[model samples]
Target: MRIQEPYTSERVVLRHQGRDRTFVVVTPLELPEQPPALLYFHGSLQNGNVARNFTGRIFDDMVARTGAVLVYPDGVDRHFNDTRLRLLEKTRELDIDDVGFTRAIVDWLADNRGVDTSRIHACGYSNGGQMVMRLLHDAPGLLAGAATFAATMPAADNRVEGLGTVSVPTPFLAMHGTADRIVKYDGGVAGLDAAHSRGVLVSALESARYFATANGLGDPDHETVHGPEGVTVDSWSREGLPTVELWSIDGMGHVVPTPKQLPASIGPGTDSVVASDVLARFFGWA
Candidate 1:
């Protein structure tokens, strides 16, 4: 598939909760009358621009192929106010309404860009992934589908009040590396230090099961597929459609899975599968 450059890109500012919030919108050259939309959330200490480059602009290819508008919303203080109970002092004190911010973005896209609000999907990495979980829990019907990378659902004791109580039946996809030290793949306390530590979490597979159960899918049918590099796929289906799926990349770490080069400090990644391509396929945009 040939990759196309975004036709136009701009930062959009909005007022919510008596504060100004901003997000980046990238439009495809050939846009549909009512295009499906994608909202991507960046990891901790990163902004929309950083995520755009770090992900190798692969999402732009999805935009090119599917005529979908891509959005990247900036988090408050470069960090999202996720569902974790133990949060940074500043983040806890501010208590930013991120879910409200997301709703505002969705509304803005529908009103200004002619986006299909019912088909909007979300994808996030690391800290951003936790935020996605918050969306899935707090704002159940907002997203059609959700994908998370290098993050898991927080353990019951470490979660905020009312989280994990209401579950949306939206299709869910999760990708995690077994070797991730920051958010341990095997589960337990996350982060290497107090500043970075978000909270405790369930195992990666358990995280997948959590969504599957919430989606009312039966036991998963597991399979090991051979790609560029090895990846283990576990899927839960209902009526022949996979409602929940997990990709466990062996020997990988905190970074997103892509053939493109990434900073080594984040830890090992795989060239076996492009993260965006998998997400596009899973979200039925491919």
Candidate 2:
């Protein structure tokens, strides 16, 4: 499919596994910019189209403030788990080529957007968070920093076969809602939850701590942002690699809320904490 580049959005189709996968690039129409660029993966219920179409005003504000470009990619129904009672499985296999895709994206951005490739970062929401964790763990040298909102680490049973070890350790940030019901803040109710309960836990933030410790980042920076609406933003990170930040919304249901947009039913603002801003802060791009 010949994807049209939206107003400011550019299109690049990657041929992976003999299938043409589409990734949308949005940012300044220049290349080799010394500013930071982000490679983002969207959560469940958010397809590439939705991710490409939905432009958060807060995100725009962040870009205006930090000059960071946002690149949103698509994830399949892709199941990363082979345990009993699996959630959703990818239509195809896990897009292992995503690493190559991301590498291409970063290279393309560097060549076309003038972005500082060394400072490139990765982030995702929900399942995107899971994807980011897998990418960082499997291909550590690819990102300088990576963060997630409402995501978890991959299960050992779901490990990609023949994936090599990570040489350059990347700092990471894992964000989640303590009260999340969808991807459960503690993994999941039946799926990841069982894994975590059985010590297969992959809470995004939890993984960061473990990885940081193994990577020799002891006692890293930890902070919490508490608001009146019972929403608490928890962030954790270490120097170098990629920083991981987790925003655990207390008493909030699934899905990060845009205070100024959408309704409260699907879960609205938990207070003044904006998911987009939190994401930006974690990335250090803001």
| Model 2 TM | 0.75
Reference-based TM-score, model 1: 0.94
What C-alpha lDDT values do all the predictions have?
Answer: 0.85, 0.58
- Model number with the top TM-score: 1
> How would you encode candidate 1's per-residue C-alpha lDDT over 1-286 as one tens digit per residue?
9764556789999999898899999998889998999999999889898898888888877787888899999998888888788767455578888999999999999999999999889999998998899999999888999999999998889997666554568889999988898898999989867677778999998999888888777664444355445788877876854478889888888988866788777788887788888998898888
Scored by Cα lDDT, where does model 2 land? 0.58
Worst 10 residues of 2 by lDDT: 78-87
* Cα lDDT, model 1, residue 258: 69
What residue pairs are clashing in model 1?
229-272
Q: Per-residue CA lDDT of candidate 2, range 124-215, in tens?
A: 76667666766665667778777766556555564445545445666666555566655556653423344433223455456556656545
TM-score for all predictions? 0.94, 0.75
Superposed Cα deviation of residue 229, candidate 1 (Å) = 2.9
